[model samples]
Target chain A: MDMRVRLTLAYDGTGYNGWQIQKDGLTIQGELEKALSRICSASIRVHGSGRTDAGVHALGQVAHFDPPPKFLNVPWNRALNAVLPPGIRVLDFARTDRKFHARFSARAKQYSYTLWTQGAFFYPQRRNFVWNTGPLDLEAMQEATTCLTGSHDFNCFMNKGTEITDTIRTVRNILLAPGFTPQETVVWIQADGFLKQMARNIVSALVQVGRKKLSQAELKSIIQGRDRALAPATAPARGLCLEHVTY
Target chain B: MDMRVRLTLAYDGTGYNGWQIQKDGLTIQGELEKALSRICSASIRVHGSGRTDAGVHALGQVAHFDPPPKFLNVPWNRALNAVLPPGIRVLDFARTDRKFHARFSARAKQYSYTLWTQGAFFYPQRRNFVWNTGPLDLEAMQEATTCLTGSHDFNCFMNKGTEITDTIRTVRNILLAPGFTPQETVVWIQADGFLKQMARNIVSALVQVGRKKLSQAELKSIIQGRDRALAPATAPARGLCLEHVTY
Candidate 1:
């Protein structure tokens, strides 16, 4: 019997090259496989709920793997974290039925983009975690997020090389929290799923509107136009974090 | 005529050993001296409010130096930050009175330590910051702080190598904020002066009492006893931040 293990993981993406296997560099998936293999004493394959680009963080990323027979006594949560690096931590673990899959079963994903406006540089210690946009207009950005909320063809908000046949994505919720703090603005978006660079692209457009480079009507037109060329540049991946996953 | 130069600095404290100028590897003072030497075309000495041991951090550390002829109009703040490596930043610049001294003339200082009990090894980025101590009694810790206020002999809290002429310091305040949403605790301390590892050591002792290791009577005895052996070990330096300074 194939035993499916579901793991909720959080990681500082600054050190790894995202949540996928890469032949050339360090990656979250690579590190997990390495730890799982050592603990179970057999080859293992781990799958993630979604792919986060390089420098993007994750607070509640979900993954599942089939445990090898030799490692029957290995506790999925404790054993894995003990061997993993400092930036990666396992929050919770569960034994799942064979029908469950992390990537396939995730019904919705939530991501948050932090914008620190007061200062261009971050707290030296937290510099790697937040995006420093340097004092943006909250009302303008909030108004723009409303236009980005409903279902739409998100081709305009995706990276150019994305290979998905359909670039359509339904943004289930986009709660633009304005003036939450004196020094920071935050945008939280939850969607059925996100295309490559979708959240970042949306953020860039919001930033533009906040800076007065674009109008709300113009932003709505960009979404309606459904042209990749219509959106602003992709915001840096460092600012985005996968906040949670809903099954 | 003597000129006063105010410096707003940032340092990683990971390399070159602490903030003071030592014969060892690299010190923040040594780096600033080098930058000043190049900019001023003459050697200049820098004085910090206080010395931070190796592996400490500062967001708004205040320092003062006398300007040499060549450094004039060099845009010292921007130039120095650009020249400094990724770990240090010079955020602001000011020219002050000739009587100013960073160490002796300083009136007060504020420090904060952050602890999170989440037990997740995966810190979002910049995990090097905020020491992670699993769940502890913050209310107990806050209560313990009241025992430490006012003028007291802090010799018990000083580290082994400290060489201060006096052991008595006035603690203006010690604020204990209960854990925030992420199960994090922040300890903020303000004082007229501090001994070596004083804040860290005080935090250590308080934490022990907070976790039920020592009683409040024991805490009073340790302070009155003025013996270094009576207190808990110094807390990790990584979690402590020199938050503010007053001249």
Candidate 2:
């Protein structure tokens, strides 16, 4: 009988090229594969809940793997964490029915893009994890996000080179939290799925709207237009995080 | 006429040893000295409000520099920030009275220590900044902070190697914020001054107190004892931040 394992992980994406396997450089998947390979005594390919862009971090990223026959008794959760690098950690692991897939069976995903409105040097500590955007109008950004709620064709917010067949998705929630000091503004979005540069693009547009360069109607029109050229540029990937994945 | 320049700086302590000018290795002061030497056309020394340990960071670190007559008209802030490396940035500059000293004139210093209690590998994104532990009880920790209040002999919390005649200091506040997701905790402390490793030592003691290993009376005894052997070990330096200094 085949065994499937579900593992929830958290990683700092600064050192890796995101969650997938890459031919040229380091990746979260590459590291996990190496660790799993050592534990299972054979090669293992792990499927992630989604593809996170380079520099995008994760707090609750889910992945699954089918253990080879020889590795039946390994206590995977503890074993993998022991050999993994200090930047990536496995939070939880459990043996699941063979049918469970980290990628295909996911129902909805949540992401958060963090921006700091004050402090010049981008926090010397948190520089890689948050986008530093001097000071922004939070009320304006909150009003602007209302336009992005519900299902819509988000082609305008997709990355230029994305190879996806569909850009339609439903956004379940859009939460805006503006900080009082250290000056921060956070946008949390939950959806069934996201397009290639969807979060970044949405952030870009929302940022412009926050700056009062674009109005809420302008955002609605950009999505209605379904043209990638109509949206603002993608926000930097460093500030975005894959918050959670539900399967 | 003597000129005292007030400077607000931000630095990544990972590469440099700390803020002070030391013979050991790269330091934030050494970097600023070199930058100022180039911009002012003469060598200068910068004095910081406090000395942060190696691998520590700062957001609102204040420093002062007194330059010779020749560079009086130079646009120091903008020119210096332009030449400084990516990791260090100068936020602003102002000319202070000749008697203003960065260290002696500081009225109070606030420090924030970030604790991630989720055993997850700190994301490379935040690796240099936060201290990761796993699942801590915040209310218990807060309840224990009461022991650290008022003026006490802090020799127990001071590092063993530091030689200081006076161990009495006043802790104005010890604020505990519960973790964001049951896996994070933040402790912010404000004091007139801190001895070497004082903040880390308090955290170490508090962690034990949080875990119910030590009673509040024991904590009081540790402070009242004035013996370094009575306190818990020092927490790691990475989790502590030199938040602000009141002049």
Candidate 3:
């Protein structure tokens, strides 16, 4: 019996190269594939819902794979995790049909970036997780988000490397709220899909707007300009996390 | 002219061999002194409030040092942090009187330990910060605290090998509260002073009582027994943190 299995994973990406296998360094995909192949005694390709950049964490990244015959009755969540490193965890596992794909079946994706804005000093506790941007103007940032929501051509907010022909994306929602503490600001955005570095660049543009460097009019123009150079530099990957994948 | 300086520090202790400097391994104290020495161009000795074992973290580990002449006018906090590794940070600095001591002048200390007790999967984000002791009985743990609080001889909870013979200490406060998430149990404890590994052992005993391995009466007997061997093993040091030191 060839059963397709889906695994919801959460990883601390601070130490890994990225979600893909690379020749130069360790990666989340490399680690996952290594454990999967070893456990089932067969080659495996772990297909993630989407690739996350280096230092970008994930709370609910979805992936699907077909295991070898030996793994038909195995307790996958426990067996796979037993061989994985402490930085990655298999949070959930279940059988799925071959027609269901981790990437194609996903309806939406939610990403969050944390900014530590109140203190002058960046505490070591949040070093690899949050961006230390002192005193961002939240009210201004919120107002600028109004120009960002809904359907728009997002070429301005994407990295130029990938050949993404269709640059438009529907940004369904965006919210800036007080994080776990008053000192932190959590920027949350949901979209049908994200372009390469799209979330980071959008966040960077908003941060510039919060700093009053880019006015609301300038932000609108940047979106309409359709130029990546017109937007602020993309934010650091350490601050970005894929929070959910809705089906 | 020599100036006495006091510093408040925060560190992620996941990688080092504890707070005190050792002959073989990297430690928080070793990193701090190295940065201090390089910045001031002198061999500086930093005296901390106490020594924390390997894998133990600290949010407000207090220390004081007498700087050489070249460091008299240096902005100690920013200067020391510039050269320190990302794991350690100097949160604050102030000039103190010659009589003020980091260890002897401290009146109280507080420590907090986090335990993950709800889910079968231990999430990677909190791997080094919380103990994964799934599904502890909080009500029973609450009932067990009564026998453990207040002034008592804590020899059973203290790890042997340290020369200090006086095992009596006052546990002024201990509270079990809902953590950031419903799955977590934050154990907050304060004491006038602590014996070596006293906090870790006390928490271990409470956890044992919660699991029904030790009854409340058994916990009381264990403390009264004055035998380190009678108590449960000291909890892992990674979950324990020096939260505050009051002077």
Number of the top-ranking candidate, with TM-score as the measure: 3
Q: Model 2 over residues B99-193: C-alpha lDDT tens digits?
A: 99998999999888878766544444456666776666667789889889789888888886667779889999999875333445779999998
Task: Report the lDDT tens digits of candidate 3 across residue range B33-151.
Answer: 89987887788899999999899888889999998765677788889888999889898999877788999999999998888887666668778888989988889998888887899
TM-score of each: 0.94, 0.90, 0.97
For model 1, how does the per-residue alpha-carbon lDDT over A1-247 read when each residue is reduced to its tens digit? 5678899988889868888998888899999999988887778999999888889888899999989755555678888888999788888899877799999999999998877777545554545555677877778788777888878888788777757978778898877664223466767989999998899988889989888899999999998898888788888887788989999
**Which docking class does model 2 fall in?**
acceptable
Judge candidate 2 at residue A38 and give its lDDT: 83
Off by over 4 Å in 3: none
Predicted candidate 3 versus true structure: per-residue lDDT over A1-247, tens digit per residue = 6589999999999989999899989999999999988887778988899999999999899999998766787888898889999899999998977887999899899999988897666668677888888888899999889898999999988896787799989999999977644678999999999999999998888899888898999999989999988788889999888989998
Q: How do the candidates rank by DockQ, highest first?
A: 3, 1, 2
lDDT of 2 at A147: 84
lDDT of each: 0.81, 0.82, 0.88
Tell me how candidate 2 scores on lDDT: 0.82
DockQ of candidate 1 is 0.49
* Candidate 1: tens digits of C-alpha lDDT, residues B71-141: 55567777787666667778787877878788888998898777765654435343555667776777778
